[model samples]
Target: MTEINENALAKMREVVPESQIHYLTKAVSRDDKNKLGCEQKNGRNVSADGIFCGGYHPKSFHVAYWGHADLTARLLEADPEWNWEPLSVDDRGLPAFDQNGGLWMRLTVGGVTRLGYGDSQGKTGPNAIKEAIGDGLRNAAMRFGAGLELWSKSDLRSTQETDDAREWLVEAQAAADVPAIREIWQQARAAGADVDTLDKITILAQERMEGGA
Candidate 1:
C-alpha cells in the first residue's frame, strides 16, 4: 500500500470553517408505500422567507455542505495543481454519462488520483450537468478527507450540540442588558459548554459591552 504523508493529510483534513458552510434541505417520505420518495431543495430556496415561505417541511431536514466554489478553493489551497477529468467522453467530445445517467470521473490532488461517481438526482438539462460535476467533485474530495466532517455521523451529532449551545450564546449576546447576558453565560457554563463555546460567550459579552448593548 502507498503511504500518505501525515502533514499533507492533516492539511487536507483540516476542518472547514463555518462561514464557508451552506445548508440544503432534504426530505423523504416515511410512509411505507412511498419510502423511497424524496426531494431536495437548496438552502436559499427553503429559507424562512423564500419560496417555501414557511421554512422547511415537517419531513425535511438540513444538511451541511460546501459549494462547488468552496470545494475548489479548498482543493487549490491544499494543492495548487489539483485537477479532475471525466472517465470517458462521447464522439462530440462531451463527457459521457453511464447507463444510469451518472457520470464517472477521476480527481487528482498532490499526485493522488481517486475515482468518484455522480448523478443528476432525477434532474435533466444544463443545470443537471452542472450539478453532476459538483457532486462528483465532492464525492472525490471525500477520499482525501476534505469536508469529511459533513459526512461523519459522530461529527454531525457534535456539531448539532455545538449549534444548540451557540444559539443560546447568541440569544444571550442579544439580550438588552449586561446582567441578562451574564445570566445566560452562567447557565451555559453550568451546562458544561466546551472551551470554544465558553470563549465565544466571553467574546460576545465583550462585544456587547463595548457597544453599550
Candidate 2:
C-alpha cells in the first residue's frame, strides 16, 4: 500500500509541477479501520470520519484513485521522474502497507479529473488504473460541467432526495388529481421550500396540468 500511494503521488507530482502540488495525509484516528469518519456536507472526509488530507478547501477540486500496489509499480516504472513521500500507518493498522486500507491518492487539477474504483483484481498496474480513473473523471466533467461544484454532498444529496419527489409526481400525474397536487404544494410550502427550486417545481406542475412537458 505504501508503494502504491508513493507511486501515485510521485506520478502526480511528475505530471504536474511542484509549485502546483499538494500532499494530504491523515492525522490518525482511533477508529480509522473500523468505520468511516463523519461525512462532510461537501463530500469530503473529515478527520472524525478517518479521512485526512494535508490541506484543502471544501470547494477545492480533487482527483482520487483507488487500486492495488502493482498499479503503483507500473506508474513509477512508466514515469520515473515522479516523486512522493511515504505516509506512515496508524495504530488501527491502516496504512499504505495494509491490504485492507487499499491505496488512496488525491490530487488537485485546474480542470476536471477522472476517477474509477475496481472491485475485482486486475492485471493492470495500480498506477495505470489510477491514471485511467483520472482521465475518465476529467472526460466526464468536461462533457457536462467542471469545478468542485460537482463535489458538494449537500447538493448531491438534495438531488437524490428529489428522486422521491419525482416518483410521487409520477403517481400524481397518472392519477391527474388536482387535489393531490394542491396537497403536495401545501406540504412543500409548509416545509419552507427554497424559493428558486420551488418556483421550478411550480412551473413543472403548471406544465403538466396544461398538457405540456
The list of candidate 1 runs beyond 4 A from truth reads: 1-9, 27-59, 154-213
lDDT of 2 by residue, 60-110 (tens): 222233222433443445444433221444677542322532333232232
Model 2's number of clashes is 15
Per-residue lDDT over 15-83 for candidate 1, one digit per residue giving the tens place of the 0 to 100 score: 889888776644322221322222335433222112232343533345677889988888888778778
Model 2: lDDT of residue 64: 33
Count the clashes in each prediction: 0, 15
Q: Which candidate is the best by TM-score?
A: 1
| TM-score: model 1 vs. ground truth | 0.55
